[model samples]
Target: MSYLELEGLHLAYGNAPAVENLNLQAGEGELISLLGPSGCGKTTTMRAIAGLLAPRAGHIRLAGQDITQLPANRRDIGLVFQSYALFPHLTAFENVAFGLRLRRVPDASLRERVNEALRVVGLTEFAQRLPANMSGGQQQRVALARAFVIQPRLLLLDEPLSNLDAKLRVEMRSELRRLQRELGVTMLYVTHDQEEALALSDRIIVMRAGKIEQQGTPEDVYARPRTPFVADFMGWDNLLPAAQAPAAARARAPQATHFAWRPDAVNVGLGEHTGQVLARNYLGEYQEYLLGTPFGHIKAYAPVGAQWPEGHSVSFDLPAERAAPLMET
Candidate 1:
């Protein structure tokens, strides 16, 4: 059985159902991300898992033990909120030790465990620093150390890295992955950032309006999205309305009755049709093109050197196999 399971979970605030018939499974030590936009129920689902909100129906299990009725204190789950939730008055070490102290662990053992947890997060050197003295990324690390100090059976992280700048967010991704692997704790992460989800999760649960839109490995979700929403959400930019693409386009595309192709997937200067480049953005690694095509404004991406100026004509071909079909429903 999965280590953490939420089966047929449903939740409603007053008369409005926020989540319905929701089911999820996380294997022991596996990291799964609940990914979606704001108001998509990802945060609500995380709250339910953390025992902040009781499900209107369904059960939650951890390591084969039913925790559906377990109160937040007894659930033995540690949650790291997006806000870090670190006490400004407490030093980093004190913050990490707060939970152990609350549980009245022996002084010697608590000190040892707290040191070990801080070390795992690479924050041992900053143990004496207050939240006000540390950078956003460092505080996030402290929050993580605090959560893991309890050695909870399950860990819930709600957009734990969203507060950091882009450069720091990238740097912390590797750090988070490393610590999670070292600890071997099951984690349920919730985030709206698609790139972060792809980089950090073993599997991703794509939710929409309180329901699971699709669930799979990063490659599966990116390369073979099961729905239009999934494809669009994952950054597939060349969306074609079902009735707009050429009849030949439909016959050639394989994944959906209606489909989209990634910009980089189209072969420029080698295909059956030619389009005029209406605009271009020169990213360092690649160039993005907006082409005026019969199908509308088609987007294409190519290597940095493989770009043409606006008003230049470019020939591009969509291989039948490269286009993805959208889910009919």
Candidate 2:
């Protein structure tokens, strides 16, 4: 059996369904991300797995034991919130040692474990400092240490880095990945950021309207989305109905209802199709162009040196080989 399993899971808030008939299996030490927009049930699923929210139906099994009805404290699960839920008055040491204290672990043993957890998160020097004195990144490490110190069976992180600035978030992604790998802990990470999911997950589960739209490795989901919703989320900016696409593009997937490709796939300055550049923006590494074409408005990227002003005509192609065939829009 998988290390963690959710079978026929149903979650709701009163009359409103949050997740319906959801099923998932996660292997030991695997870092799986539940990715979607707000209200897509990713956070709700995390809450259910953490035993904070009761499932309207279905079972949750962890490490061969049924935990669907277990109390939150009794279930060996640790949760880190986006807010970094630390007590302002408590020092980092106390915050990380809180769970051990609650369990009545002896003073000597709890001290060793708490110190180790803080050291693992690279916050050993800040142990005597209160949360208010620490930087955002340091406070976040305190929360992680608190969760890790418990040595739980599973860890649930709900947008843990969302509160950080872009640079810190990127840094934490590496830190989080390193911790998960070194500890070999199974984790269910919840996030609305597609890039974060792509960067960190062993597998990505895209959720929509309380159900899974798609689930696969980051490469598979990004390169070959099965539906328009997923294609759009995965950064496929140029989507066209199969009938509206060029003959060559449509020929690549005769049965597809639609086709999608990223801006990078729209090769500019060397194709049979022509379009007027409606607008252009320098995007650091490449120039993005909005082109008004016969088919529709298309977004494409070209090399930084390839500058085409607004109103200029440029030739581009939606190469058939680069298109992702979609069965549904």
Candidate 3:
């Protein structure tokens, strides 16, 4: 059995259901992400797992033990939220040692554990500093340390890095992934950022309308979307009709009724297909183009130096091998 399992899980707020018939599993030491937009039940599911929200139906199991009805404090799970939630009056050392103190750990052992937790997050030097004295990233590190100090069975992070700047968010992604691997802890991360999910997770569960739309590796979900919702949400810019689909994609998916292509798959210049550039944006490393094509306005990207301005006529193509066949729902 997988180390963490949610079977037939149903969550609700009063009469309105937030999640229904949801089932997922994670292997030991694996880091999985619950990915979706706001109100998609990703946060609700995380709450249920952390015992903060009770499930209306189904079961939750961890390490072969049923924790479905357990109260939050008894679940032995660590939770990190978008907000650092650190106590302003407490020093970094005290905050990280709070849980251990609650467990009535020996003074010597508590000190050892808290110091190690800080060291793991590279925050040992800030141990005596109050959260008010630290930067956002440093405060977040302290929160992580606090969660890990207790050595919980599983870690639940709900957009924990969202508060940081874009650059720091990327840095924290690497930090969190490295920490998870080094600690060999099971983690369930919740996030709306597609890049963050793709970068940090060993597996991803894409949720929509309070249910699992698709669950798979990042590559599988991105390249071989099984449903229209997933194909569209996973960044397929051009979803063409059957007749317009490239022939190669059709051969790979004989029964497919449509085709989808990522923005990068459409070559922006010199091709059998042509389109007028309706709009464009210069991203840091590449350029994005909104092209008015027969396929109903395709989005395409070119390397940084490609400078086709808006209103420019450019040739492009939906390469046969680059398009993915989409099956009918």
Top-scoring candidate (TM-score): 2
TM-score of each: 0.95, 0.98, 0.94
lDDT of 2 by residue, 71-157 (tens): 998999999999998989999999999999999999999999999999889998999999999999999999999998989999999
lDDT of 3 by residue, 1-329 (tens): 89999999999999999999999999999999998888999999999999989899999999999999888999999999999999999999999999999999999999999988999999878999999999999999999999988999999999999999999999999999999998999999999998999999999999999989889999989888877778888899688867766666677777878888899998988788789999998888899999998778899889988888889899988887887777656
- The residue ranges of model 2 lying beyond 4 angstroms of the native Cα positions read none
Which of the two candidates, 2 or 3, achieves a greater lDDT against the reference?
A: 2
Instruction: State the RMSD for candidate 3.
Output: 1.9
In terms of lDDT, model 1 sits at: 0.89
- Cα distance off (Å), candidate 2, residue 272: 1.5
Query: Which regions of candidate 3 are displaced past 4 Å?
Result: 243-252, 303-309
Clashes of each: 3, 0, 0
Model 2 Cα shift for residue 13 (angstroms): 0.9
Better of 1 and 3 by lDDT: 3
Each model's lDDT: 0.89, 0.94, 0.91
